[model samples]
Structure formats: C-alpha cells, structure tokens
Target: MTAPAVTVRTGMLDCIQANLALLADRWGEPLRHLALGAHLRFRPRPGPDGLPTVDPPPQTHIRQARALIGLVPRHVHHDLEPEALRALSRRTPVVYAVGDTHDMPWLPYAGRARMEHSFLVSGEAGEACVEDAYDNETAWGPARPGRWRLPWEQLPTARTAVEFTAPAAYRAPRPAVALDDPGPYVQAYAAHPDRLTALRRLTSETWLMARARHLHAAYREHRGESPDTHEHLRRWDRLTATAFIALRRAERGRPVPDSLLPDLAAALHADREVFAVRDEQTEPPDPT
Candidate 1:
C-alpha cells in the first residue's frame, strides 16, 4: 500500500527557508518575517572548486529566525538510516542536505554532477515522499519542482538532516521588528573592496540574497506599502542576472566589462533612494 502523500506549497528561493516556510504554514504561523533584516555582506570562503565563494549569514541567523515562529531546528549528521529518517518524517517534514545530488533521481543534477543541495521529505511510511520546490537556473539546467517517491532501499544517506520540532508548550511568536532601512546594506555592498570577486561569488550564491529581497518585498506588501519594495525586487533580479552573465563571460576567457560592478552598485543606490523617499512620505507629522 502507498503511504499518504502530504501536500506542501512551493516556497521561496532559499531551500531551507522554503521548507521552513512550509512547516510554519502547516503549524498556522506567520513566516513573512523569516528574512527580515536580510542584508548583503561579503563573507568569502573557499568553495568546492577551490575558488573563493560568498558565504551566507552565520547559522545563528537561521536559528534566530526559526525561534521567531516557535520552532526549534535540530541538525543531525550521522546515523541517517532510512528507518530513522522515516520516523523523523512521521513527526515533522525533514530537510535533508544531500551532499551529492547525483544519487537523487528527482534533482536536475542526478546522474550528471555532484552538487550539494537540500529538499523536503514530507512522508515516509511505505516510501519517502519527496517534495523539491527549488526552481532555478543552474549550470546543470533549470531545476523545476518535483514530487517523487524514493523507495526505502534507494533513500540516499544525507550529509545532514534538519528536523524542526515544536515544543510541548507552544511559545508565542516574538513581535517582529519592521526593518525598513536599506541604506546601510546597500552601502556595504557598494563599498566592498573586492567587488569583482564578490560578484563572481554571487554567481553561485545569489539564491540566498535573492530570497532575502523577495521576503522583504512580501513583508512590505503585507503592510500595504510596497510600491518601492517592488522596485527593490526588480533591481535585485537584474543584479543577479548581470552577475551570472559576467561569470559566464569570464569562464569563456572573455573580458568582463570594467563597468559591471559600478553599474550594479549605482542601481542598488537608486533602489535605496526610492526606499528613503518612501519612508519620508510615510512618516507621521511631528506632534510636538
């Protein structure tokens, strides 16, 4: 007999955030604040290809974000047997960080390359019901949403599995602070000493940054003040595309234009200006 399939809506660009959002939705909690205060910073690290890469914010950020919704994430690195995973799934959807995507048949990189990736497993009685909602362009190809079942024998071992569990006594969500200022973040990005390298790193790390922008936009829209927020989203989308194009050109030994970083920075500054103007317009008249 087939296990009952769980229905989960597609989430944001960040895989972990996407799964967390789904879980938050399941628990009837708010998640628009998950990416609040998301900002751009140049944290460089060596990637698998032995080249410098941009690192996302520290794990503390994720933990803090989860705590806002009264959920705690436990990360397990070893003893990921199928039965163990199945038991975890019985309690909550599991987010698995697959070190090598080549073994996961549902991923675009399956049988083609090894890419570290994450996806959600929603059910696992007879078989593991997998839901991968990551739809983005990658070196392999465009990865689309996929819902498939992995038999118990074929469930690949995960490098780490994150399980979000609710405490017996539900904790009230903390009041969310409105992070309306974008000036500092934009300034930091503009002032990066090694922008060309930063842009190169962004080619692979755009998902998280883009996810942050998307969430901020959603939060603004929720507050019914999103005119400038939409522009911020558009500017970020352009930056992501431009960075990818630059990376591809450099890969072919073509000269990456010198104006690339300056031009992108200018666009971000323009976005900041829009936000500044909006804030002024919305501010209450001084009541002194």
Candidate 2:
C-alpha cells in the first residue's frame, strides 16, 4: 500500500510534546498555551541504593494541559494488531509508545539498544507513516526528527497508542493566555525540605525544567513581550547544568563543595526577584 505524504516540524523538547504539536498543527489548533504554567512537581521514590530518586511527574500533567487547550488524549493499553492500527490511522494519527526503540529503524537507537519511546504514526494499508520530532542527544546517539514509512509487519511492536479527540465545543486556534508568575515555582524548588534529594533529581530531570523555561520563552516571544524573557532561558540552562555537574561529581565519589546547594538557592532567589520586578512593571495602574 502507498503511504500518504505528510509534513512535520521539530521544536518541542520531547516526543510527547512534539507529537501533540503535530496533532495541533494538523487540526489547525494553537499550542503555545502548553508552554504556560511552567513549573516542576518533585516526587521522589526510593532508588536501588535506598536513597530517594526523583522521577518526572506523571502523565496527568500532560492530560490537564491538553484539556486546557481543548484536546483530550485517549490511551489504549491493549496492543492492536497491525491491520487494526492501519485502519485506525486512516482516521487520525496515532501517538504510539513502543517498548523497545531498537525495533524502530528511523530512530538512532535502532540496532543499538532497547529504550521505551513514543512517536506519531499515520497512513494506512501498505506502510505505516511515522513522524518523530524529538531531535536530541540520547544514550545511543543524536535522535533526529524525520518522517518515514514502516512495513506492516514491523508496526505491531507498539505497546500502546494515544488518539486525541475534541469535545463538542472544540475550537481551532486557541489564544495564548497570560503567563503564570514564576516566583512561586522558583521558591518551591529552592525551599524543598530534602535539598540533597532534590538536587539529585534535578540532575536527571533538568531537561524537563529547561524545556518548561524554553516554552515560557516561546510564549513570551509569541506575545511580543520583552526580549528579557529569553535571558531566563539561559539562566535555567546554567542552573540545571551546574546541578547536573555537581551531582555527577558526587556520584563519582569526588569532593563537591559545600556551597553548591547554597549557590543554587541564591540563584533561585535572584530569579524570583527578576520575576517580581517584571510583574510589577507589567501590572496595570490601580483604578480609583
């Protein structure tokens, strides 16, 4: 079967956001709102060494964000036969989560190692069209974004599929809302009870925080806000990188300076100060 032509763009920081962006683009919807409310929720779990390790927030965050933008994702757990998937693709694109990336020829991980990943699938009949916009450094190599066709025999490797549906009041092109204040979020991170565990989690999940900052920056750009917002992006990158390096050194049993956490807290305080000033400047005059 011949696959239909498709075009995809890469800008999001991860596969989930990228696929959602693709779906929004295809449906003529606005996605800048996903960048709103950029904050992190720290939920630490016991690691193999009995120390608390941080895990990225659950899928509920994605669902809530999507709902705000008028998209609802339905996740189907039972694996669907290749033929059934093809039929479903004929209707809408599928966001597939595969157990092993090694089976996906288009990914850098193919033939190198097994890693759970997600990408968009569409088209029907002969070959399944796959679109992945996650272009980043991975354990295997740099994963580049592109579109390709997978033979029906190879499509069944997907463990779950997510399809998006709109409500009865669905509207295209939702307007970008006001940016949430960043002061509270910065304070929360700085004042966490378990500073060591928080820093360790930040080491691995820094990308998540960095991406949120990127998104917020994008939203500010879209609204023609002050270019100063971009400065926050760089600050977040530096903050995350510093934490990552410190944690790596500790993990290697190297001497880490005692001032590391205090420095991070000071940086967070500075961020809160900047945001507070920006908020004050953007605030409207009181109407007496």
Candidate 3:
C-alpha cells in the first residue's frame, strides 16, 4: 500500500495516532490492527468469564503510543541529558513532554488544571520547533483538527519524565492470523482503560460516545445552526446508547442479540467515516 497521507492536524494523542496510521500503512497493515495487536500482545489469555483480560503495566499508554507511532520509545524521567539533547537536535521528529495544562498559561486550563501530556517535536534548528493540537482554542473550548507550534523552551515540563524514541521496524502477529483469532484484541480493549485502546476499539460504545460528544460540540459551536449536525448528534447518541447495551451484554458474558448486530455494524462504519482520511487510496474495512 502507498503511504497513508496525513489527515487534519491535531494534539499530541491525535497526532501520534495519525502518525501511527501512516506507519501502519508502511507496514502493510491497518493502524487499528497494528495498535490493537500491540495491546493484545500484552494480554493473550482469557479470564475466568471467558473474556480476555490483561494486567496493564504502569503507563500502558506509552506502549500503545509507541505501537501507534511504529516506534520503540525510550523513557526520560529526569532532566534532558546531553545525548538526548543531541538526538532532539536531529532533523527527525521526536516526542516531548508538556507537564500539565495548568502550567500552560495560554491554555484554557491555565491556573486551574493539569493533565500529563506530550507533543510532537519536529525540526530543530537553534531551538526545537514543536507542534501541538492543544494550543489551538475555539469559542466552545479547546478544539482539535488544527495544530500550532512554538519553541521547545516555551513548553512546560509537567511530567519531567517522558517517553521518546525513533520509529522501529513493525513487529507483531500477522494481521490475518491475529484477526482470525480476536481473543487478544477483545480482551485488551475491555481490560485496559486508556485513550490508546479507546481509539483502537473504534466500534466500542465508550469510544463512540467520546468522539460523538466532541464532534457534536464542535458542530454546534463552529458549524453554525445546521440540521445535519443536530441529526448527526441524535443518531450518534442513539447509537451510543445501543452500543453501551451491547458492551454491557458482552461484559456480562451474555451474547449480543442477532437483531442488534446490524446497528452495531452501522455504528462502526460511521465511526470510521468520521476519522477516515478521504484520499485517493482505497482502504480495507475493519475486521472486528
């Protein structure tokens, strides 16, 4: 497959995900499969209830993030070292830490909140130029779909420790084999609670709810009064409610009824479209 073109620029997580999509394309697999495969590898067996489960290690996000970016991350908790500084000086992109939103005076959460986060570091000349989606603000609140950049020193060091690494060779179970047996992916999705898995589980009710709410708000504030936006929200809400029911049934080991399968499938397709990169390349459908 040709390289997946970049989509709308966004914050750290979204940017990482976008980059992952590109890398997954390079690896001859879908981003969702590559990401879910990483999470699944950490937890490969079924629990007592016959559902898959995993005891997530500290900062599982790093692993999922790295998987999505197709890189092996190196964690730096202390101050930047000489070697690290030299690495950042390179033309290649890297990840950098931005302590908390509270520490960022320009952000809405300034003086009020803190969220441990990181952003992408692009080209570095005398000072590194970093890009982040969080810096962009709109009337409703902080919105994504756009990105901005500034010098490296301008960013706050919230979590003095952060993870960084260059892209690595893609290594995971073959896509066909993994999809044929989805025990690992299912378990990984339900067992761990994080943004990475949530993004990977595109069909899950929780993921749909979060994405729908964000888009719903954006439409109301930014898109002006449009019946289509309202209708979209209503449909998303209805689908979200039903998906939650399906999720609950699955969690309880109760089989999802045949009647709800079509709706669930539709929801998945809609979710994909919302974030789908509409380029010249034809992509494969979700196997889940």
Clashes of 3: 2
Which 10 consecutive positions of candidate 2 have the poorest summed lDDT?
Answer: 279-288
Q: Candidate 3: TM-score?
A: 0.41
Superposition TM-score, candidate 2 onto the true structure: 0.64
Clashes of each: 0, 1, 2
Candidate of highest TM-score = 1
lDDT of 2: 0.54
**Whose TM-score is higher: candidate 1's or candidate 3's?**
1
In candidate 3, stretches whose alpha carbon ends up further than 4 angstroms from where it belongs are 1-5, 8-58, 66-69, 79-93, 105-107, 122-125, 133-140, 145-147, 158-168, 171-288
Model 1 spans with C-alpha error above 4 angstroms = 1-11, 29-54, 74-84, 87-99, 112-115, 122-125, 167-200, 267-288
What ranking emerges by TM-score with the best candidate at the front? 1, 2, 3
lDDT of 1 by residue, 122-167 (tens): 5746788876656666687776666678885566666566766655
Give the runs in model 2 whose Cα sits over 4 Å from its true position. 1-12, 29-58, 74-77, 81-84, 90-103, 110-116, 166-201, 243-260, 263-288
Q: For model 3, how does the per-residue alpha-carbon lDDT over 1-288 read when each residue is reduced to its tens digit?
A: 012134322221231233333333444433332233221122233432333433222244455545333555565554553345335446334555435656554456656754444444444455544444432332237633323344555556534434455464654322111112334444354456552333223333333243424433342233232223345456656665555555556667676544443553454345343333233223322222
lDDT (Cα) of model 1:
0.54
